[model samples]
Target: MSSKLANPSSDRGRVGMRGLRASGAAAALSVGLLVMTGCGSSDSAASSSSSASSSAGGEHSEDLKLPAGWKHAVGTTDFQGIHAETKLPTTVTDATGASVTVTDDSKIISAGDGISSTLEALGLKDKIYAASKDSTSPAGKDAPEHFEYTKQTGTEGLLALDGTLFIGDNTKRHGSVAQQFRDAGTPAVVVDDQATQSEKLQAVADYVGAHDAGVKLVDSVEKDMAKAKDTVKDHGLQGHSVIQITATGAGGANSVAGTGTPGTEMIESLGMTSVGAESGLRGLSREFSNEGILASDPDVIVMAESDYQKWGGEDGVWEAFPTLKETKAGKAGKIIVMPDAQIRYSSPEIGAGAQALARAISEN
Candidate 1:
């Protein structure tokens, strides 16, 4: 293994909201569709890899129509799995095709994606050494190192840590460099199981040797999600109309949390309607006009806390879409912001995300 590791970053540099919309998130959404559509067979990955196609959200009983070639990529109630223990120095294979042998799990560093929260849910938070500075999850709150992982992670900095094992998000972001970490002698594991929550948790458990913990975490997730929905329903927020807008989107609220993406699922779990899904979008999201927002006329709108801050908060939203002031959400000051992890990835922490989202909209 070389002491120096090649940077896994591309010339484009830290992928931004727009860049991911063009590539990475699209990759993740299709993988999610595989799971949501019951493509859980051993060969589902092969089917997902063949093309980016949307499937109906089979898990949801609603008549919601997913964006074409996109499927519901978040929010689930199922939580059943076989329990197992792992032997030390186990070799795990990443979806990106790299097989890693993990000898230690003490000094873990995450790209600060949803997997960071998943690690915390797995009771491995103390093992995390560093994470993304932009992370809003509890796992990164006391992290020793807060790196600048904006979208996709860079592999070059990880080599210097001399950590025993590395975990990354391949289905959504930071997936292209599994081999790079392998060359550096650190066992690199990517959360590549995208078809189902059970499969996803087990893959991560196998890599970190925490099978029992992973199984328990699933039941916890189910309970938490159920509780979140019940809480929101108690508030009489069910059937509420809402739309999620990304700060990077133009025309203020034009960037949508469209059908089949985590944002839409989060919205639904909170007992709200996703205008993005109702509009019959073709992919995860697409730019819409202010006129479209006026037509949907949602009761409230939401944005990611990270993106909101990056864009400069209230003033930013107003400036991005001057016409938004005319919309119902804007007029009533019902615009809300939630953490990035809560609205982005579908993982074991989805229940927490749902709970957080429930609070955000309920309070607003």
Candidate 2:
């Protein structure tokens, strides 16, 4: 676990999408505006992989003390190949209320890891041409091309992939590109930045022609949540306070999850309190502050593995922010760490993320 820490693939989007987007950057793995946007003949065969792709390098273990019902995320999310689309050229109304008729599920680009990871849970991992880089996760870890959600770029990257459709998160880049990708023959289906986890899952699933898979994926999320919360309640750990802290990359901008964000929802749903939420930091995501942390004095301090490493782990965090020593979590040494991808991306992995977090809390 110590050896596998990769810097976060992208910054924790400060915007409404929760670190999935960068100011103007593009995260084009593959997507296109097809029939609705007059898509050109794009030798879609060029984009399809002949065989199923596996994680790049190899699967890195987080060494999580997973709860009873949860399995390791890699092979388990494939749904046993249950893709249930009935027709081609299906019309999908994306998060933006725009319609796109997808012609090829064989060639797809997940503009963000949210879509990539969600699609992987839907058993469509083989169809993904690329995914966000450094997404050490339940899925998209092996997506050959490193997808980036920061720094807006031109359509050269999009056109090169020759993908049939692009699934993106609603962000500055995703929103501003409605017609850019369309004009490039890439029909983009942007998922709402603020959609619930299930809605986000259903959006990408629908775009990729996996409505049935989407339902199952959503159900898995719900069941996982129920199990996770039960574990917390069973362990007598409900309402424990937590604050997930993440850096931009190694030693980058420090941020904390607040109210209305996936991190908070996951925490509260598991019957715990988010320090940021308790303090009324309503930005959904907000800057990390030593004074604020001391004020709320959470029960546990959650950190992304990369940030944990950057700060030289628990001992280092205590030294750098000596103020942490005054907090309840610090006095008890309840510092926690998890994979960056699970906590950062609001995809199917979130439930698994919560379960892992729950397991950690029960231990604490």
Model 2 lDDT-worst window of ten? 29-38
Local distance difference test, each candidate: 0.55, 0.57
Worst 10 residues of 1 by lDDT: 27-36
Candidate 2 residue lDDT tens string, 221-241: 777777778879989997787
Off-target runs (Cα >4 Å) in candidate 1 are 1-87, 97-99, 149-154, 192-203, 231-239, 248-255, 259-262, 269-271, 277-289, 304-312, 339-349, 352-364
User: What does candidate 1's lDDT look like per residue over 1-364, in tens digits?
Assistant: 1101111246644332333334432210111111222123221211122212111111112222221221222233223243334457777677776667788888877764556656655656677887767556656666777776433456566667666667775545556555667776667777753334445656677678877767676666667767778768989998777677665432223366665456676566567777666665522355444444444567776665555555554556656555455667777766654435546554565665576556545655
Q: Pick the candidate with the highest lDDT.
A: 2
TM-score, cand. 2 vs. native: 0.71
